[model samples]
Target: MAYSLDDLLNPQVSKVTRSTDNLIITTYGARGQGKTPVATKMEKPFYFAFGKSGLSGINNVDFQPVNSWSDFKSLVKLFSNKKNYEQLHEKYHTLVLDEMEILYKYCEQYVASTEGVRKIKEGNGGYGLWGDLKDEWENEIMKIIGSGFCVMFILHACADDTGKIMPVGDLKRMLPIILNHSDIIGYVRGNGSDPETGKPIHSSLMLSDTDEYFARTRNEYFVPYIEDYTAENLVNAYYDALDRQEKAEGTSTVTKEEGDKMYEKQRITFDELMGKVAECIEKMCNAKRDEEVVDIVEKTLGKGGKVSQCTAKQYEAVEVILNDLEEALA
Candidate 1:
């Protein structure tokens, strides 16, 4: 079928309906840190308990007990199915995977058994088996996450040889894969005395990464730490961040000339470029050294030139500076 010149030249504009919010949240912490209870507090939660330990104190949340990797796969399949997806979505707003580490162990065991090996690193084909297991686990979990349901994975924290806290796993490759897919990664902390009550605070969620533990949030509006970790609080924070982002985007528009220039240079929209530049400027200002800021701008974006006047190559250099500054500040 051939189209007319008008059809080819003119494009219809539609209202944007897609959201940039991170619906997949992963939380890791020590045992009895209230991870399960906090997760269960989400609206219309459907919890999948990989271990019975997390189920002791929680109540009133609909839950399913999954003992094996096969069970996990079956659940994923049910949710991924189009016919069943709508029903599940109506019944549950959030799907919680309690003790995701146990699920990963089950995946490891299943992989080993299927390959007729005693361990993941067994025989001459150990690396191949590990790769297969990693792929399988990532594929299955991602399927559930992409099924249009808000998903939360609850993991047990373990320290690596370098003492960096991460989800319990033998394969170091697994952590990055999971974190890459997650929108929010949080660490639950407790074992501190409350100053006011002088009582033990069972748990708090750290939403940003520090030198001691691995955690992060894509939402800039999200607080670095939440003293009370609850499903309601987490959901509220996420929506609030989304709202702020929407408002910011609404005010930031790219002009036709700017859009054309960006296109010519294979660059992003003016608004996005300016946002990055603004962030870099703010960080530089926070450093409180005029001479250092001047040197950085001159070295990256050129001497006496504003970011708005930067070429694509200069913008890339400025971005590199921004990344370095962010890491240094962090």
Candidate 2:
């Protein structure tokens, strides 16, 4: 059925809210400079060590030893599985891709082997192949993100010919893609000594396109510079910033009647919301395995519960989950 102009212009169409809980943090530093230490401090971190740099010094952290690009891809698939995601949600809060520079090299090698080419260049059509590989990597990353895990990438910093510290890879093509998806980029530095203790002081500088390095934070509360960098410290800083922003927005003083009126103005009806939910579920089921789809429904709406029986709040939750799923599939 076609809608009239009034229905089409209805303001109560239901808007989506963004979650600030998940973070994408990228850190770079020289070897033995406490890059792994920062990651080790995160809540229940699972490390993917690609540089053969085993978590020798780090204790009691779960890690997967990745040898090749194929291994990493398989690992991504494993994590994307619905059953594993449920288990992982209970066991881990963060996923760390250690030494992303090595991962990039492996991606290059994988492209070369698959395309029967020796180098990635535009002339030999390897550039297009590299783009495809990058897309694959991005899809896996987004899936992990959508699964509600904090994604962290550790890299070894490289100095360009101009002595500017940058992520070690195809900066022109690949770095922008990585940066665009990242919420924070930090450059590690540890040269100064503590004034009182006479011990070395290590710090990570969150950048903003400086002449010396590339760093930034989407969170305004971040000082754009940190004298000390620890996983707990950064996470706390983020939430504190979020809290400040929330407070700055001020609390609503509307009464129940006023609030109800406002909500009525913005809220989509139960039937309208269910229609969108059904369409989203159909798309999700088509993109995922049947068991995964069933698991998601059960988790969100209870065992054997149909979408039609969901309450308005439950429908909102399902909508968010389905949106994440569709984005991951995309």
Best by lDDT: 1
Q: Write the per-residue lDDT of candidate 1 for residues 147-263, one digit (tens) a residue.
A: 767788888888878898877654565566667778889999986777999986767789888778988986676778877777667777776765676696673433334433432
Which segments of model 1 are wrong by more than 4 Å?
Answer: 1-22, 123-128, 191-199, 251-330
In model 1, pairs of residues that clash are none
Clash count of each predicted structure: 0, 3
Tell me the TM-score of each prediction against the true structure.
0.66, 0.66
lDDT of 2: 0.69
Candidate 2 stretches with Cα past 4 Å from truth are 1-21, 121-128, 161-163, 194-198, 207-209, 251-330
Q: Lowest summed-lDDT stretch of 10 residues in model 1?
A: 13-22
Model 1: how far is 209 from its true place, Å? 2.0
Q: lDDT for model 1, please.
A: 0.73
Per-residue C-alpha lDDT of model 2 across residues 1-330, encoded as one tens digit per residue: 223366767745332122332567888877777788888788888899886564876788888888888888888877767678668767887888887777777877776677777665532553456566667666655666554567887888888999988877676544665677788888887756779999877766555668888777876656666667777777767666656655766532333334334444355676776776677667767766656666666776678866666676675765655554454445
Model 2 TM-score is: 0.66
